[model samples]
Target chain A: MSDQQQSGGAAVASSPPVGETLMEVTGVSKVFGGLVAVNDVNFIVPRKAIVSLIGPNGAGKTTFFNCLTGLYRPTTGRVNFDGTDITAKRPDIVTQAGIARTFQNIKLFRTMTATENVEVGMHPRLRSRVTGMILRTPFVRREEKAARERAREILSSVGLKRMDELAMNLPYGDQRRLEIARALASEPKLLLLDEPTAGMNPQESEELRTLMERLRTEQDISILLIEHDMKVVMNVSDHITVLDHGEKIAEGSPQEVRQNPRVIEAYLGSQA
Target chain B: MRFLASLRSGRDTVTGMIPGWVLAVVLIVFAVIFPYLVGSGSFLDASTQTLAYVIMALGLNIVVGFAGLLDLGYVAFYAIGAFVIGWFGSQQFPDVNGGKGIHILASDRATFQPKLSGGRLDIAGIHINFFIVLFIAMAITALWGVLLGAPTLRLRGDYLAIVTLAFGEIVPRVFENSTSGLFGIGSTDFSHGRQGITPIDKINLPWSHDLLYSDANLKPAYWVALGMVFFTIFVNRRLRDSRLGRAWIAVREDEVAAASMGINLVRTKLWAYAIGAAFGGFAGVFLGTYNNTVNVDQFEFGFSVFILAMVIVGGMGNIWGVIVGAVALSMMNRYGLPQLNSLSEPLGFDVTSISFGIFGFFLLIMMVLRPEGLIPSGRRRLELREAEIEGSEDTGAVGDMSQMYEVRQ
Candidate 1:
């Protein structure tokens, strides 16, 4: 395993950095009794770059994302985002600091329309006061118009323009796209997509891969993705971080990490 | 030509316009001319009282309907509002110096005194005009709403419901027991327990002074209540389309998701509770003046349940639904039962309680048949159907559901 890692490790040494340093996690660890979920993990993701965190089951990819997103306080680590320490901030506070994320399970307001769902994401940006809202003053009306326009644009960008329909009525693929559009509506500099292509068909996965690339290139939004699909991750990710047993075992370009024996064993059986 | 063109275009859509504006105009005109056409003063008076309830239901709709909060103790705010007017407007507060000083100045020339008379405490001082008391009552009630909302905003669902219920219960008891040394006021014989404060100041206007039925005139109070109903409707419509309204709906739909979107859940919830409570308070004050009395029994749990039923039956989260529900329910409670009893007597049956029993049965059927009410909010109707479809479609997909949960877990 060590020999296979050293052979593939040299190829990743000189890859170009596409994204800006949007998030830097240093010495992060999480322990529950005798089990360590995430152990001394260190990583850096650049702005406008599509990065993937891949690993086998119980590899702590979700836990690390949770800690960074402020869903859970890290046992020990400092997570700095855009040069601000946001390790212990609440999820809402973290979102206000220009970071947004989608959950592994879609957590959309299922009862609301797709447009309304997108409009909710724009809540922090709207400036109408309660009195103004209740009174339906010019300020509130103007803000509403602007927010609706923005939501429309976001929905279009995610290829969901025709689906002004209620969120629950959307087909599965469209629902996933709506979720991304909703997250994008928050106007985050960094977007964390956890298992974006978890249950999609191959065609849907391919479409998502293309969408991820386009978002990084056009929207100028950095992405930190957690994916189990090796093909999609290999194709879309500019850089890859491989985790096994709650620790980063390999980190580099797609070609380099692909041939690493430790990564192979983590995915395939040891005998193979 | 333009009108004809627009009419043609309107007919092309599946969801055609129902000419709601014209309907509203007709309703308003009828409401204005009803008392004269009806000819019976008692019937007119009950009609006006029913309108007040309609306004209150609309206010409650914003909180329970739009925000999806189950507030079981909404009557507390109403009680506070009524008592504010009763205590101040009637000059009923006893003098502080062992009943020897002038505690309040009255609008009319009435002598001051404090004594136990006819199983009640008699306190005499300056009584304020009903209108002034009404304004003060609304303001005080709004303030009390803020007080209740401040501590309980973080609670959600059943917990919030329970806390609000307790607050509602506590408020009336606090007022009823104010003069019983429970609040450390030294048993000054004011707010005499359970019996409640009586001789509440009658609401009157200057123009009605020379008119017949002038003193304790129900018409003046009717107009005021009508004005409030319009004002409430106007405010509620504005709020529903505002950013705050969106925040409330967002919180209602998904608090965690709303918060993640940078909506402050605490603030949004508090605003909904406070605004709703303020309306309840205003209604309470108006009710106090209308009856010319205030009693602990008047703002009981039953009233709260009645208001809840009004909101529920009208349609949770729909403004128009609440108005319709309120008016219909009020009419049923006030007039429907009596009419039913009259009809029953002619048929040789004792059916005095038939109307309420029928109402309860209708509610039970509605809960099973259309949980969203007769006219549910657009969002509610859509979600309910979606849930039904999903439930039927996923009968054998339990494994998939568990798998999704596992992935989420």
Candidate 2:
């Protein structure tokens, strides 16, 4: 429990943010016809912090993330990202404004090699357009070279040894790592990982925890996560926000969130 | 050389076991001497036509193969490109010159002249050089591409195909009907209606003094067509590895993921149409000049379907596969079924008339035997295999794979 308090001491959402706020969500909700998947969730992600959004199944955790990332426009709400009014800006715009996400199902381009997938991640950063590609100008060549080197460096950083292997051919854990590598290749200041440890073993989850910490400290990147595992949620997050039926029930340090009565009731009621 | 090597490196990424460099050199040598080996007029003409189709297939490959846009009416750009030549390179519209011909880049020392007497109008026809018209055609077709792609931005799958097919059909008919401008929107006669334009100028280099598209010796035309084919292949190869191409493939694979990675789908899809349409227009100029006509009848839905078949049969994303597919199908259309006259003697049916059915048969066979295509790209082959695997796995249950793959209503 002290581990949770020590980790959360760096940044807490309830208190005025220690770092500049990177994203601000106000009353964000999503309704699917008859179903309200998410409802009136307000939260903030501070700069260079790992924030966890934890909720039980169908609690609208993913839906909340989707709203923030513009996969689905919030039924009614506003999201400001890095000083830009990014509400309902398409996913590409969201990414260009420094937010990149990975799918929960791991949607890697199955046919392209791992490196190629990473190269695709670097698309927004690439300067050469169609004409330069056809002309094969010196600048295009140099850009391509820089992109390849960066893509390769990202792959090795993610512990994916083989850049040439097709994405689908990689082991399950490696495929997950490759997806992160691809997201990192975008040079995103804010990374929204759907579930970095979802389907990962204990050892793999440990590696992911260390990796997330390194990403926060070394790369100076903020991470927003939808994590189910308490181990990851408690150990890695500087701030924890629990969502139930798309409503934010608790927002504070991990230790404070753990002792919240509403958080317990929401999980137990949903399970029952 | 590194850039060039990367252009031809698609296959190497998949299976680089073979030394393709030697194979490429041999193929180039064979292509350089192809006209001389069979100096016969008919053969040269057939191959030149095939090369023209090759340019079109490469262009369409960018749309359907790389971008995964199922465009059924790609020939619209070709018609527009051909008209660029028809309007500018020939004397189709005579009022523009005020009875004086427009001749730039024409040979000065030679006495050769265009046939200006046979126009449908009494006004003297203008004749600009072929080189300038080529660029104009590309620009026009590229503009039309953006225009056509505008409505299809929000559409996908068969719906996108229907809209594009409609656009394709509309262009030629407008060209056919707009003898005195579009629906009375303008005063000039853009096309000659059903009668069509004629006497398109031959392919003329800036330095050439003679009409090179004559039937007596088509060697120059062959070289010109071959040069365009090389240009098409080179551009196609370079594009296949570019960031734009990667974005196309990304959009094709998963649009949401690609967008999340910061690829603007609208811009990517439009670029595919514009660049692809430009290539179609490039070949259109050559085809219009080589055929010596730009008739409305030549622009048909069937020609679009024929080009689509070449792309499908060759291999969707593979540039080499598309080229081989175009050449093979074009040759077969010209010579294959005709050579099967012996089948007519035995079956008591005209084999030549059933050429389309034979083509259908070949397509059916290719689909049944090798659905991935003749030279399947690594990506397409994997897609086909995954589909196959999913098909078998689904058959074991009640829900079919087709249901999942079907476009959302």
Highest DockQ among the candidates is held by which one? 2
Interface RMSDs of the predictions, in order, are 5.1, 4.3
Fnat of each candidate: 0.63, 0.73
Weakest ten-residue segment in model 2 chain B by summed lDDT: B400-409
What is candidate 1's TM-score against the reference? Answer: 0.83
lDDT of 1 by residue, B246-355 (tens): 77888776665677677776677777877887788778777876776788888877677778888888788888778878888888888777777777787887564454
Q: Residue A98 deviation, candidate 1, in Å?
A: 0.9
**What tens digits encode model 2's per-residue C-alpha lDDT throughout A1-272?**
34543433433344423579999988887887888888776789999999988988888987787788777788898999989999988888888898988878787988899999999999888889678999999999999999999999999988889899999789889989999999998899999999878889999999999999999999999999989999989999998888766666678888888877667877776344
Which residues of candidate 1, in runs, are more than 4 Å off?
A: A1-20, A27-40, A199-204, B1-17, B94-135, B150-157, B180-190, B204-217, B338-360, B391-409
**Tens-digit lDDT string for candidate 1 (A72-106):** 67889899999999986777778888888887767
Chain A accuracy of model 2 expressed as TM-score: 0.92
Candidate 2: count of backbone clashes, pairs at least 3 residues apart or interchain: 0
What is residue B319's positional error in candidate 1, in angstroms? Answer: 1.1
What are the Cα lDDT values of the candidates? 0.75, 0.83
The weakest ten consecutive residues by lDDT in model 1 chain A span A8-17
